[model samples]
Target: MFKQLFETGIGVIAIAMLSWILIWMTRQARFLKAEITDSIKNALGEDNRADWGIFSLIFIAVFWEGLETALFIVAKFQEGWTPVLGAIAGLGVAVIIGMLLFKWSIRINLNQFFQVMGVFLLLIVSGLVISVLRHLDAAAIAFSHISSSTDLCGIGKNSCILRPQIWDFSASLADRQFLGILLKTIFGYTQKLYLIQAVGYLLFWTIVGSLYFRSLSQSTQLKPANKFN
Candidate 1:
């Protein structure tokens, strides 16, 4: 329980970090709604208004991320109070961290912040591959175990991808239980992993994140040392 809670909590924080980082890095927000938050501040003037605006945008975005998790819980489990409580707790932790950064006079470079957070995001992304693999593994186990067919012998075969089920827990990497479910929804997790799932996840990050970052590189402008995002 504790393990799932801890992993889930970290996962939520990582998601929050990734959200703000995306807000910072992308020059033109791909989504219309997200554009208003980041670029609006850039148009405001970096002195005081822009600074406050950036913070507000980040704050609102983080809130939205938390709210999304809360709503997801409500949608998944109609009367579940635990997910709501878990969402609040997870959001609270992220808020505290933000408060510390805002309150402290310590200054951090925007690019460096993204770089660090980006690395952390990558790590979590890798874990997602592991999670997907587990899901595929579950499918393989259930199909192979039940069926007498010898053709579906390979990992993540057609018999598995079409029907997924939990296969094992002794080596499960994901969190399970109430808090764990909250955490998983807030972050991203599956207790088990499979070969094909891991490869697909890797392709996603390698292709998508690279393209996103590449676009940012093309769009970036020369700015003062601390001003780069």
Candidate 2:
């Protein structure tokens, strides 16, 4: 019981942190370059070691990206090796892209790149919102069983706390199936979905998605004006 609860808590924290980071990045996308430049300039002015300041800046940036990647991988660990493999593939692609952009001095539309990736991540995290709620519900059910609390879940209910099961598509497109697993990994698809889970998923996309797209649009609008000025 304790172990299940602990794992669930970790998953929740990891998903929450990932979601927060994604949304924050969307909102700060426009200012990130300027902020980094300013930070580097400030660091360089603090001492005579300009090279050391630059190195420090690079170290911090790499450390932050690594931390985010670690958290994401940890969050997906319960799903088995598939997601891990996918993450490794993604890292390779990212490295290649970085080399092209930085080392080869290739020009890419960073704003568009971020916009597309932001949308993809938001979809994934929205699914994660559902996953977190389901995990909490499972933990609650497990605790109720261990404690012998019959009242926690009424008879014939599929969930102890997530409300009645809305639908079970396991007979048709079971989550264990190849396509189902793909959807589950990419979009958080589930064979059994509860009312609360559906509501939570939609609410995440509605609120977080709105904020992200709004910020993205604002950034796009401001970019041209800033360039002209």
Candidate 3:
């Protein structure tokens, strides 16, 4: 019971951090390079320690990503080795891609790359919103049992006070199946869903998606002006 509660708390924190980063990255897309250059210059001051400044910038960026990855892994630890393996594979792929883009000096459309990745990540995070709510609901039920409070879960075998069950697709496409699991992992698909979970999922997509798309469009509009200048 306590374990589930702890995991749920971690999920909340992970999702919150991911959502903030997604929105922030989108909004700062245009100014991020300049900001980083400015930060490095300020950090080095008149010393003009280009090497140290570059190293410091790299270290901080890597550390920030590493911290987020750790939190994400911990939040999804109960899902078995799949998430862990995926994370490792993703890191490997990212490293290779970084080498190709930078070390090899391969030309690629970074704007398109980031835009696509942003949308993909947004979908995944939105799904996590639902998953987190489910975890919270399960934890609440377990807590009720420990406290011997029947009011917390209402009636029925699967009844949850968090929100009434909206749909159950287990019979047609169970989350345990291959396709179902794929969707569940990638898109946050579930065999069963609750009112609050649905609302939370859609709301996240609506709010975050709006901000991201708006920022993207604004950046696109500014590109021509930047080119002209």
Highest-lDDT candidate: 3
Give the alpha carbon lDDT tens digit for every residue of 170-212 in model 1.
2544366755564455445555434555565567567657765
Worst 10 residues of 2 by lDDT: 220-229
Kindly list the per-residue Cα lDDT of model 2 for residues 1-229, writing each as its tens digit: 6666676688678767877787787777668877978977886788779868678879999999999999999999999998899899999999998999899998776667778898888888888777777778877777677676455876555688888789999999999999999999888899999999989888887887887788777777776454322
lDDT by residue (1-229, candidate 3, tens digit) is 7776787788788878887898788777778767878876776786767778688879999999899998998887789998888888998999999999889998877788889999999889888887778787888777777676456775454746456788899999999998999999988898998888888988987887898898888888876554322
The TM-score of predicted model 1 comes to: 0.42
* Candidate 3: stretches off by over 4 Å: 35-107, 224-229
- What is the alpha-carbon lDDT for the whole of candidate 3? 0.82
**TM-score per candidate:** 0.42, 0.67, 0.67
- Model 2: residues with Cα > 4 Å off, grouped in runs: 38-106, 226-229
lDDT of 3 at 126: 85
RMSD of 2: 5.4
Clashing pairs in 1: 133-193, 133-194, 134-192, 134-193, 134-194
